[model samples]
Target: MSLADSPIRHPDTASRPLMTRRGWWLVGMNILIPGSAQVLAGDRRLGRFGLGATLVLWVVLVAAIVTWFAAPTVIYTIASNSVALWVVALGLVFYGVLWLVLTLDTLRLVRLVRTQPSARVPIAALTVLVLVVASGGAAYGAYLATTASGFLSSVFAAGPSEPPVDGRYNILLLGADTGPDREGTRPDSMTVASIDAETGQAVLIGLPRNLEDIHFPSDSPMAAAYPNGYGTEQGCLVDVCLLNSIYTEVEQVTPELYPDAAARNSTPGIEAMRDAASGVTGLTIQYFVLIDMQGFEALIDALGGVEITVEERLPIGGDENLQNVDGWVEAGTQRMNGYTALWYARSRYSATDYDRMQRQRVLQEAILRQFTPANVLTKFQAVAEAGAETVRTDIPQSMLGYFVDLAGKTRQLPIQSVELTPETGIEPAYPDWDAVHALIQDAIATATAEPTPAESAAG
Candidate 1:
């Protein structure tokens, strides 16, 4: 047809005023409210579908928030459910795809109204680029959620433990060693971490591994076997009554003592140790997380090692009795790899268990400080894998979200620690339970209180 004399006119090809601005407006509308752009562009059917999908998403999100606040157990149950996680992962994928399609459709509407061909090409390309980035981010988030759900399911048990009487969660942190020379895994390091539910202030009460005359709660199985105190009635040596020996002794002699615990907990020996620790510390141990010492090196390596101040030369490899130091870590503040850090925590060459206990606490604090979010994100996969392998706990997966929130609070609070040692008037051979309890209570009180100028300065 001749240019100006053509009788036929293209209805869809008509040049519209503010075409470029309208195209940009459609992009903005799609970004803010997914379907509104389609509706404004006269695509009622597609717009209705998009609006319905968005409504469903908002409803699900609101329900999750309500459930998290009202009934956290339900959220935990959902998080622990493998099928639920799979369904959520699939739903996220669908949402991502739909979002990408809607973005492209919005750009198409822009093209329909666009008068300049050159402008349309760049606008469409830019719209696709933005949608691709957003969709990619959503997909990555979904992947991380799936990985976390799986890791939680693998490491933590399903059932919940009762909270302590003082409105705090007392978790027993046990470092278990399962060497070939030993009959069974023994708790080499035992500490009760009493955490305030509201403030996240924590008090670490360290129990010396060689503490003798270990008391057992009246209701505990150990008490039933040895009413006078573990190893006291048997007339065995003090080493038989050491606090750390309770785990191996119980596992060897009475593995079936706590049948109920077997339902939610895998290690009955650790449960026995928890009771003994509870008896001595005067604080109920709600849950226990046992870290396999052999796997601990891998976990530290996964976290890219930890930085700590070494006050003495620590030995790495030695005989079964921890004698004849083959390798020594020099005394200094330095970043240690997994093997050196593990030795720094476990070494007992010329040092006693009490000294080792203090070193362990320092190593723990260093790990907490170094395992920052930036470091975690950088090596998430390795950390997740190592953590799953190293730790076995009775803490349910449902409580993880709450614990994560509590951890955020803990980062703002000071950690108070009390170690039962000879310097603190605590005799491992004849530990006074009353004095130990008072020390722990004092630490907890100090941690929960607002810091004074002197306390802040000292800290």
Candidate 2:
């Protein structure tokens, strides 16, 4: 039916016809459903196209949104969170563009109805298609923006708080940059954190795995003691865990058995290693986190990039380093992605193990910075998904809420870290097992002993 042929008109609304009830309906739909307004105002073709186009665009936008949160991570959440802002801004721009376009098209429809009323049906259809497609795209884009927005709203609903515990606690954070090198299933990087519950102060103690001859738990009885092998509860130290030896044993397994060789390497029969490590360090272990390498990279990519200070400059080695595909970077405080940070933390050959420990600290700080409310709101789902995919932790989900609540309550607490490496003149290989045991005992004694007022005031 043609607009001029059919009789769907409003009485007493002829003059200034474009502002009439029917005309306004067309404009409103143009704003709300894109082509539907035009189709109602006699634009068939446009309506059909707009509807189809809208569906397609919606599918695409929703897919991106889902992927972001499906495997969330701190890095992904930080990076993807910014997308909400971009989505809202772009959506507004799109709305403006659509409004201008539809307004002009509305005028064209009016002219068609008056001049060639016979052409109304065809013109209306075509207009409908155009409006439908454009509006659909806009609507779908909006859905994405809305979904992303809601994510941020929930995560930043409150401010940072304090922890439940009220004393000093130590947690070992392991980032297994699981890759080509490693033995047995064990962590790639281990970070020991001493948190003062009373003061909300934190200390990260970095320990190297390759310091050769530190006391570790031995399977045999003789090795269990200091004389034959590093023995006694306090004899074992970080050096006792042989990285190369552990790596070699784990490498024998086919990739299938350990699909994520790097991620799972530190996981195979971790009980022995953990027990041994606990005995060696004398620090009561509380919690542990293991992060996936690739997922970790995706998260960093999502966060835009983490800013960190390069303690020292180190060149990227040749192609021999499979993971150095991103090439070398200079030493200085600069932005880094998951890949770069992973390399920096794992670059044992390029620099001393001690240096790597420092880099790990830098990465840890960067992680905390990336978790700001603004950042979390932008990438909540994505980061959450990434963390789930690439990371595993002994801290159960039930307890996690408590930790988060506690952290939120606490103000920005001071952060400190310590490292027990061979550089400290604690070579496990040269010294007798007895010496190593004594060292572990001494470390435990110092860690457990209450600090005097003078020492506490120094900081």
Candidate 3:
């Protein structure tokens, strides 16, 4: 019937006109099984709707839990897609409002004015507590979903996808180090991640920032400028005109190098770096991810920290020599904050850049492996905010779902790395560009090769 016509008077409590014992029982029943009090007493139709909604929600929740167990990658895919997240948020708000309405209606059926004065406070408090527990959880979930959706939209682009070349998708990863003191943007750390399209097998090809005379593709805009190699036309110092300088040299000094770079929603620097990377790796670079190292420390901090073993003591900060040592990281296994980890991955005060390159690779893998499902869910907002500031890429947002799924598969497989260093081969000063490309191609070939039956069993 009507809310005003609630059955406040009970025949069982007729002996006591102002007794609240029956009121407590009905409210408790409503809290335990929403709308149960109405089902047993007043408004059976409303009670049925509440009960049906609860059952459907429980079923959906159970299915989602089961899917998480059976195929977690599916969950990641759904989580990354903005459309899916919006739908989930709407669903949560719908269920939350339904439950809230039922609970409030149940409170109306209690008819607090007819209950004993002494029991009124406790009954009201319990009802409010129940409302908060049931509705607040769903509200929080909806907020989280909306936050993730906005994050995905703001961070990734909507560009069209590029097909893989020769069974592999090569992504250029650049860590651009730029600041007030620095002359221009220079991607200090560069690597090419070549992943198999069908299988998730992958190899990381590390390119030293100091590699000299980096060649560009034949048809590249830069090919005509430095026919022999980079730095030939620039007339810059050996230390200044390294592989990483290609970015700054093009963007600041020679913006006219790539005429259509701006139209492509890219910078002359990034396009130049991509071409140089392709020439070095002998692979068609499909996309590029530029990580702002200055802001990237925040992401590492959000992830708590990274742990690594130090083979020797290294100074935290110094010029090119150890004359001005800021601090020292003692040798051993230790966990470090973002600032310390940055130094650990890049310290070259008393060591070689090759040493730093190796450390950087280890640090990269360690941070990636740190991502577990539990931590990601709990600290999602923090991670997303830090990521927005840390990454700029040409990878399409439409491909985020596919990339998330691919990441899951990649996590399950082994990752191999090939570093071009002094120990490995020719000198960086007078290097053989052809040899470096061959090494990268061989690494990709070995990474994509199918394992024999005997090898598979052994593995």
Best by TM-score: 3
Clash total of candidate 1: 1
| lDDT (Cα, tens digit) per residue for candidate 2, span 431-453 | 44355446544543454454534
Whole-model alpha-carbon lDDT for candidate 1: 0.78
**Candidate 1 TM-score, C-alpha based:** 0.78
Top-scoring candidate (lDDT): 3
- Alpha-carbon deviation at 328 in model 2, angstroms: 1.9
The deviation in Å at residue 133 for candidate 3 is 3.0
TM-score of each: 0.78, 0.51, 0.85
Alpha carbon lDDT of each predicted model: 0.78, 0.53, 0.79
Candidate 3 stretches greater than 4 Å from native: 1-38, 69-73, 110-126, 233-239, 259-265, 449-459
Worst 10 residues of 1 by lDDT: 3-12
lDDT of 1 by residue, 174-259 (tens): 99886566666788888888888876777888888878877788899878887887776674322466788888766776778877
For candidate 3, write residues 82-135 as lDDT tens digits: 889999999889878977887788777677776777887888899888889888
Compared with the true structure, model 2 gives a TM-score of 0.51
